[model samples]
Target: MRLTGLPLILLAGALTIATVVATVRWWRRLPIRIAGLLVMEVLLVLEAGLIANRMARFYPSWQALGGTPEVAVVAATTAGRLDASIAAGEAIPWTPPGSGSWGLATTPLVVVPPDYLTCPDRRFPVVIVLTGVTPRPAEGVLSVVLAPTARTNAASLATVPAALSADFRVTDTYAVVAGPGPAQPGLHALRSFDEAVRELPPPLTAPHRLPS
Candidate 1:
């Protein structure tokens, strides 16, 4: 849990008030009152020390909470590049560029058609899918959910399953919420799904292409 100064301050104030009220109520009971007060003091002291240690980093200012243009670009660039409705495999934590994207470990789940490597053009119909927040591979979902239907129609769809914050093994504190609020910097994150229509595989070059 993020220990911020405001919460600490509020907790300290509450504890102080509680201690005072308890002491006043038990003024005649010296031993009990003193012990209660001591316990409160210890809590306050521990809280203060923790806040002091994390003062510089925790409880960021309003300006710091606000999103900057550079951060927005980074998020947009790598938003859904992790895993989507395109491929299959165990996703690895990765970012195309730097750590600016979502400030969290992002992943790139890639899987092409079975014949992609040997196909003439190696240019598969890449479908970037954003599934419900199941925290599973998007490609797997497509294969199970749509494979039967796709086969019936002779359809070939690739999947790239990517999510903003889904590396539970990485960090428990990882989180992302898409909203207009300040906490969710990526307001228009769904645009990544739209933008993926034009996105080719990483190389976008000859190596991934098939031999003529």
Candidate 2:
């Protein structure tokens, strides 16, 4: 079941109600009553926590609560050219030119659009994806994915554009949004660039069409 949704909420409420009724019905039986009461208490607490989680969105899914890593780009360096990578729409590990100055630990992953090679002169807009936790090389493709720390700011991330420009054909315009973090600086960077970002994945908003 989903961690947050009406269905789960209804199920929890039903369980709580069942526990309450059972506890009351077994009141005369000491052991049965005690067991029912204990079960009821636990159910009530779980119901309350589920309700709060729904409201606050602290955990969007059971996997998130269980600390399971989200799908990430699996970086492979077998592709010899940008055309090869773009054609396959593969994710590649990139060290952002001078990422050391930015205080980044893991190398960022880059996924170029499948149509990248089709338009030689056309520069694509960049979408900087920032996750709450660092993603492993397990899944996904396309877009510039950055795993920044709490201390990550626009200044520290300034080299990103330069690095991407050197490695890929990208325009000055870009969009910044929290893929799923304190992405205030990213938004500010968007304004600084004075252009819109497109092709954002699910849970992230975008105005243009997603990459092909």
Candidate 3:
């Protein structure tokens, strides 16, 4: 079964309750009681951990816990296939190579500046736009509209620029803009603004911790 959802939490709770009832019913037998108590404790801990995961979303999926390929590597290898019809300054549907680990249900979108076609040697800075709903790309800048919680995670955010660099001519420097959502957190050294379009080369600051 998939992890980190209401169903999993309910299953864990049910198992814990069953263990507790079994322990009480078998109290007459010393060995059974001891084993039941031990199982109950374990189940209780498991239930709590599951609940916490549901609330905090530490491990969205089994693959995320085991760790997937780095975003840079995946982007370099798999993100090379671009449709012939794709044009500059237009939003392109992107799977975002390493997004499997983030458990994204929808594909992310990327918008490169119109000059990106003519300016072959020029590497443009990137802007990460985080939104809870569908995103509308801005003009002139390389915009990456991320699905909610697609590594808005500061620890994982650093790898994104590197990933984009593999396929697109983008610089290491990037700025983040958080739209309305629960995924709001300090994105590594990158500070998030309500709207930061056309603001080239934002200042880098100390990393901030995200809630676990």
lDDT of 1 by residue, 14-54 (tens): 88778878877887897967887787788778767656646
- lDDT string, candidate 2, 99-199, tens digits: 77765546787766665555554455676766523222221223677777766788888888877766676655656646433454634433221122323
> What lDDT score goes with residue 111 in model 2?
67
TM, every model: 0.24, 0.44, 0.47
Better of 1 and 3 by lDDT: 3
Weakest ten-residue segment in model 1 by summed lDDT:
167-176
Candidate 2: regions farther than 4 A off: 1-86, 132-142, 184-186, 189-212
**Cα-lDDT of candidate 2:** 0.62
> Residue 120 lDDT in model 1?
27
State how far residue 124 of model 1 sits from its true place (Å).
44
* lDDT (Cα, 0-100) at 150 in candidate 2: 61
**How would you encode candidate 3's per-residue C-alpha lDDT over 34-54 as one tens digit per residue?**
999899888888888888887
Which segments of candidate 1 are over 4 A away from where they belong? 58-212
Candidate 1: residue 82 lDDT (0-100):
30
